[model samples]
Target chain A: MIEKKYEFSGVLRFNHWVRVFTMLVLVITGFYIADPFIIPFYSSEPVDFMNALWRSWHVIFGFVFVASAIFKLYLFIFDRESENERISFFDFIKPRIWVQQIKYYMLIGKHPHSKGIYNPLQFVIYTIIFITFIFMSLTGLILYMHLYHEGLGGLLFDILRPMEVFFGGLASVRAIHHATMWIFLMFIPIHIYLAIFNSIYGKHGTMDSIFSGYSWHQKYFKRRKNKK
Target chain B: MQNRGLEEKLSKRLEELSKQQGIDSTKSIQSILDAKGFSRREFMAWAGAMTAMLMLPASFTPLVARAAELSDRLPIIWLHMAECTGCSESLLRTDAPTVDSLIFDYISLEYHETLMAAAGWQAEENLENAIEKYKGRYILMVEGAIPSGEESMYLTIGAHGTSGEVSAKKASENAAAIFAIGTCSSFGGVQAAYPNPTNAHPLSDVTNKVVINVPGCPPSEKNIVGTLLHFILYGTLPALDAYNRPKWAYGQRIHDMCERRGHFDAGEFVENFGDDGAKKGYCLYKMGCKGPYTFNNCSKNKFNQHTSWPIQSGHGCLGCSEPNFWDTMGPFEEPVADKIYNTVFGGVGADATADKVGIGILTATALGIAAHAVLSKIKNPQEGEE
Candidate 1:
């Protein structure tokens, strides 16, 4: 028999959807700012400012994406609502769990019991994604600092000048920013596929847990009942 | 005492050289200024301006004037390799010829292929003699990229057909300082862009010495002369940025110093050429202006004797001052992100942009995921068995 259990809290689900919305907006507007496919009417006055409009949206969502990512990171480290997420580090460190997870993915072994919400593979992938987010944010700020040289941009220029030099220059920083956006594009499809695969094969409410805060559990309860 | 001894030696040598050439060396700079109708007060104002441009104290105006007068004492050997003579032409072709350009003209340029009267065997002999005579005291200024490696044959100098690489290496060997005068000499300019048929490299790559890069398609006269004056006055290299470009001239982006910067912040831009915004001097950010990426004093020190620069003429900055700009800052009328990595994976055809590559990989990933899902469904006959 399947038992419904609370897996993600309200905060986790909120952060997840915020990241999803922000990423979508950021990508679309970022692409537009990069290429600006929309051209204004030739006879019309040059007051459209289509590029600037798209760029403003892009900058707004870029900040949102960074803020959401930071909140998620904070939750990962110190969220009292879900202490098990922090325990995911244990799964990442265990070689036996890694082998088992690989075997499960290859359809040669049963899914390894994870002490935390994520398996070893999931933990590692999430860690890398978070790091890429940080890199993307830094390169984004470096590019932004050039456009507006006053207020926050001025402060960022002073702080991030060394980082810009380290990456070679503004051109390299731009190239890196464009390249890292592809990382997100690559991750999204695979992430969705894996979530769907787990929900279908594992007979658990894995995909539903992202929308609702609960997932279905069975074996753990059976083992606990038998022990009682 | 040592400094005075060197000054005395320099003056005596100048007098003897003037006597040999039948020219008055004592009043060369002053006489030239006077002939050009530049008063002493006007010259002092120019000196003060130069001092400010060099980021020196206001008190150093007289020092700068003195340095300009003594500039002829310093020997400079300018070499041209694998480039258009645009940088030289820009310095030489001013309407009235500013004090800086005049100083450049007055300097003891021992052997310049463009400026020197000697040619062929005689020019080669002059270069050899200059290198021998000046030894470690003369400044070596390279005007273009050096074709290096196996493609060294692409740029051969003199009747002897010596490679530019060998010539630059030899000339810079005993030089007190080296100056890469243009983007070509600093970062291998246009010839080094994409495919790079001649395999050109910046002067710094060919020589073992530190080269001060004055990188532009043709850097402004002020920047060129200001760098020279800095070296002359301080007897040392000026502070350089990460790219070895003198920081005083290339310290800020063109976007920051642009007159239309207010429009940029106000969300006003020239959507097209000859538009109302363009006529009104709107920011050229949408017109693929590389001003944001380019670090140069073109806005502050306008080209053509401070008359107008690229932006002032309603054209966007091409980012000519940057390294590898021909490759990095292209589709010059579009944003940098529009076309990047022009020669990816060793020439995958020029049209292959970063976006195309990205979209291609993302499509393949989606296809792979679909195939994997189908295979998983087919292989797992006992559904929900776990």
Candidate 2:
């Protein structure tokens, strides 16, 4: 029998969609800032601040991205509606579960039974993505300090200057930030592909779970006579 | 030249100040030029150049000349720490002493390790006496980084073996203004790169007072002289950038001012060391020129008396003026894209760039997904087969 299960909570889906929107905006504007491909018309007066415009968009989305990540962390830790998400760490620490998951991915074993919402591999990858998010936010803030030296930027400067030095310099910080963007770009495709793979192969409605907060699962019946 | 009235007025004022200070200013600048075999015409030419360098109007030429003439009024104390004295050599080692160098010579340098003839106890005594005498009046110029914390033992100065950290702290305690004269003093230079055995730190890290960083491997003579002149002319610090470098000199990116910038805009670049494009004097961006990121006036004020700089001579900018350049802007013969840190595998993938690793993982994912799809199709021949 096929059973419908209410899996993802509304808050979790909201945070996911916010991350999606902000990541797309951040990446597009970030690449523009790095190497501005657009130019003002040659004959016209060079007055348009195209680079600055792109940079402002990038920073705005960057903050939104960070806020969404923080919200997700809060959900992972304290959200009563998603308390089971924290139990993924137990699966992450189990060597047998990791081995079974790897074997299943290698096509040598049946799909491993996961104790929580995510498998061990998914849990680990998500953890790394979170770390990358933190790094991106920090380097962005450091770079921002140079552009705006008053108010928020000035305050960040005093706090983040030592961190900049620890990272070797502003240049290294920039390199790291640009590099971390690529991580998200790489993750997005695999994440979608895996979701599709699971949805089709597992017959679990995994992809629809993110959007509709419900998924279908196989139900097992005990060896007993029906009441009817 | 055209501003003769301003020139006369400044000269008269300088004379009165000279009388008040009991120092002869009438021929002090002229005498230094004469001793160095430099003519009054050459000095005037230099003054004109300085006026232009300082971004002043033509009328300010006389003001610049008078500033150089009155350079003696500014008492300076230069300290040498964990450095090679390259900054001092760059300023003072011209085959023929330019008027700029003479102006530096004309300054009332109360104490300088490289220029002074005194040594050992006598040199120590001179430093002590100068610090005591000038008190809070002299400009303190430091040439190198100071070892921090317990690593202060790495660099000890004077006959009594006083640590660099201690010396810098003491010298800067009573300074009117402080200038970190090179990359070493500005951002700890190479000594603080990577492993940083000495635990070296920039001059600003050790002192509470604001330090105007004049950072370069060896900063241009014009930059050094221009900063000093600006201080003398205004009697207050010039505007500073985020790095505490004088905005007048470090405001614009080297890429914007570079002569090869046209080539960069046109998308013509030098791909290799001796390629046709390189021979054609194309942009060095492909060869890891850090000009786009580096903020300095190397292109505007070329080194060795406005002759040529690194980019002009077919070499990429080392980005030496920037902080921690040795660690951040290295593999200087290639573009920055190739040096992006491999964040995935950490040190194991140190040589691999983010692009390479990212593309590698992406390609693998695509292939794996394709392979997995094929395997799943073969394993499950019909619906609900499992």
Candidate 3:
């Protein structure tokens, strides 16, 4: 009983690359955006010259980000579910299996006991992160529009006034924007590490799958290669 | 050996210096020779510069040509009280003046404990002598606060009876004007934090004399030096704030001038450390940053030779300039604004910005999540039934 393998489509490749490219630029420019040191990195330019650039690009790329997310949603909604069913409800709740999968990656335990294109836990964690990002992206937009444009932003500012205290002050709000950068930073190494691991060990052609749209699967259905 | 030309003027002056010898001239001349000091040719050139320093209007630098003659620097008496020597370090760190230059030349330092080698009773006596010789003519610089209440036992000075500040009190009494340097001396910095054991207060608290408080954890050197220059020229104080600090240095708040202010007005925030928002360099008011209430010229004056202030360094302004800043400005908790509490504790601020942003984000995220959940549920209805 061989499990069928499905591949990522061209649209999926587009979404993945756009998300990666935009986020990388966002993170680097974002660092300078946090603080504006006047001292020049070299002789005369000052360290924070890039901070100005960060603000403009952040605003511009944010639109691209939103569009990309929307395209992802369209695909998720319209496309058929992968024959492998990598994402599932059981993956959301099974912490034990999640931990076990994580342990397998570290080589501290035997291979994971679960089977699927993605373990249940991977779907669960990604779902949480994805949802949070959507909310953050929306809030970020409202905040931007409220500032550069007029009319509706005032109403938004009025509503946000109470929570303004949550930021402590403008300086702290700047800090929040600064620290959120690390979350995306954390996700990057993890995402890359997993993709590489699948390529080398699982022999799934995971890296190319993102581009070529076809994944290698076992010839036998519903059974491990070694098992009878 | 005497000539009337500039060269003659120089040689004749040297002859007069050797012939009219005295203890003061002899000792200084000997010290200079021992140090392999400047040649006579170099000395005259430098003498021209020193003369300008003395005669140039203290408030104004004049043109480049006129500032060349030697001028007498105003006499300054630096008095230390209960302090950690940080203010001295701050003042002396000026690369422009260079600590060596300040100690050796620039201002006429009649007496300074940290910099001067003179010590014990001689040091104490020198302070008294300078005050007595130049009373109402020299600047009285006080570092650290003078604790008024109790025995003042927290700080001890040379041979003071009950109060630890016997020397400070005496030195302060005889000087022309006083500068309370550092937050401790100006506004009782950290020592005056809550429940001050010594019952510490700035120099202004103890005396009726005009005291200009330069408030900062360590006051900026330019503010300290520039204020002195202003005073020397004007023959009066720089305009004082309600707290008696120079208005030129304390007129603006850090909030009013911050570069990140746009993001704040726009309502962008970093929700947590190292999150996307943080990386994006949004605002930090939520993370307990204090920039609004504090008043100081740090944004403009900058630190380390106009290098960068704390906020620009990615740390919040601790409000070291304000009175009782330790108590009032500590604890980075929010005064009131955005949301995303410690832990996953969920709540939303109705701040005008947050409401609009939150409402829109909430509506969209909720709708998106709900739609995702429903569509997934409907797509696999039997899965949900399980």
Candidate 4:
């Protein structure tokens, strides 16, 4: 019952890193398009197209983000590897896990008895983050139509027009999209810190497991000590 | 400043053109154009300009001109509420001053406080007569925000006991269609900005009618004329966007049609006023230009007869044509901040604050974890391998 158990599958790890890379591209390019901080040249001819270039990158990556999100959603639902992740939703809402997680994060309690790969808080937070990613993708495309007049961007106009109105015009849509970016910005540091914290504190090689697809189960340490 | 000289120059040209066409201000459009002196080709050229401003095809020029000539004169009831009269002034400053002024002759202007010769009770009587005579037939044009608080005492017309809302409601009661002219009337312009003390409301919000918003600080002369002509010719309202603005006028962002858009796309920006970039006509995106988000044809349909626009004059857009622009599109020279977080954190500014605080928290977290690791290592030397 205690061994190096496979936690993240190759596909899940691929999706996770792809999301990270696309998000990085999106945030940098999006911010530049929102307000270009660097003035490469103040008096360049109109043909420079720097902002347009950033926008193109932003939009191109935007689709990649969308595709990755959709693929992640597909994997979440249909892939057997994600069955535990799906069931973690129930554990995430459990009152006992809530209390245990709070105590653990506060450093007052040991890791609670858990049946899922992700702890309750991680489950909850990741779920919310993914939901936000979906929203950001939709709103981002809605705002993108402002610049694009033909091709795939133009085709999406029929759909985004009504959403733009429902969201209270372009300004509000842009504001919401802008504000959500800060969420990801804040999430990255906390996410990295927690990953490293768990890896080092539990001696579980959790960080390496993302790439290696196997983690030394914490219970394996207890079983090995008993055998010794 | 320079606008004065531009206006004088524009008026002089209009005068000279009218002389060449033998147009008399006293005569109607039909009379002047039909007169032996005025050619059909000249009229067609003017029609073409209006068509282009309306975003209509070249083929629509003859159709628009024919409509202008054959359409029945619309009866208009112009009402002033909580406004600065800027919309009216814009109309007066039209490049083709003679023809733009002739828009009055084409419409039976039942009541106009600024331009009507009638004064005092005579004006009141004129309004009443127009309403009674053209009930359900005239175009009711409301030119400012309608104050709704404290019995609407914030704005009143003449010496009567009538508030703006009251008068607007009565006038629009039986009108065929209502036109909310100017940002104030259409979207509560400046009066409806934050801390709107007067409780100003746009015409659509105050009334249950199908209101058409010709929103601008003051819309261009062509838009005003185009909207009126569309109504006159088609006997129905032009297509409207979600904001109730005519789609042709407010369909696209100013950034799309801007002359300086090349600079914007090229990432060349004017960082400050009178800077070399600004002097050299660089994009004003960095200087808080709201053109990218603002949906108006100001670039193409330049104010004062295509003379200039805000961006052309080397200033960022105020986003005047947009709804709640005063409240939403501010700091005028800086991008809008995330109000919730900025205000919550005592307005230290955006992006930078988030970045600093984010980095600060992460650094503290790292140090705390490091210290904890060291303490644990001292107690249990094998903690890393545990």
Tens digits of lDDT, candidate 2, B1-386: 65566456555655654543413345488777787788778888889988888776677777788778777776788999899999988899876677777666555667889888999999999999888977876789999989989999999888999999999999999998899999999999988887899999999999999999999999988898899888766667989876899989997778778898766655556767999888989778778888866889999888887778899999999899999888788778766656745354656656777667878788988898788888876764356545
Chain A only: TM-score of every candidate? 0.94, 0.92, 0.72, 0.90
Pairs that collide, model 2:
none
Task: Put the candidates in DockQ order, highest first.
Answer: 4, 1, 2, 3
Q: Sort every candidate by TM-score, greatest first.
A: 4, 1, 2, 3
TM-score of chain B of each: 0.87, 0.90, 0.68, 0.81
lDDT tens digits, residues B219-299, model 3? Answer: 877666656655544456777755677877775667767866755545555556677756766666655566765668787
Between 1 and 4, whose TM-score is larger? 4
Question: What shift in Å separates residue A181 of candidate 3 from its native position after superposition?
Answer: 34
Candidate 2's C-alpha runs over 4 A off are: A1-170, A204-228, B1-27, B34-41, B340-350, B356-386
Better of 1 and 4 by DockQ: 4
DockQ of 2: 0.20
lDDT for every model?
Answer: 0.82, 0.81, 0.59, 0.76
For candidate 3, the per-residue lDDT at A33 reads 44
Best by lDDT: 1
Which pairs, if any, clash in model 4? A49-B265, A49-B266
Clashing residue pairs in candidate 1 (N, C-alpha, C atoms within 3 angstroms) = none
DockQ of each: 0.33, 0.20, 0.02, 0.46
Question: How much is the lDDT of residue B266 in candidate 3?
Answer: 53
Query: Evaluated with DockQ, which candidate comes out highest?
Result: 4
RMSD per model, one decimal: 5.7, 7.2, 19.3, 7.7
> How accurately is candidate 3 docked according to DockQ?
0.02
Could you tell me how far off, in angstroms, the CA of residue A117 lies in candidate 3 after the best superposition? Answer: 74
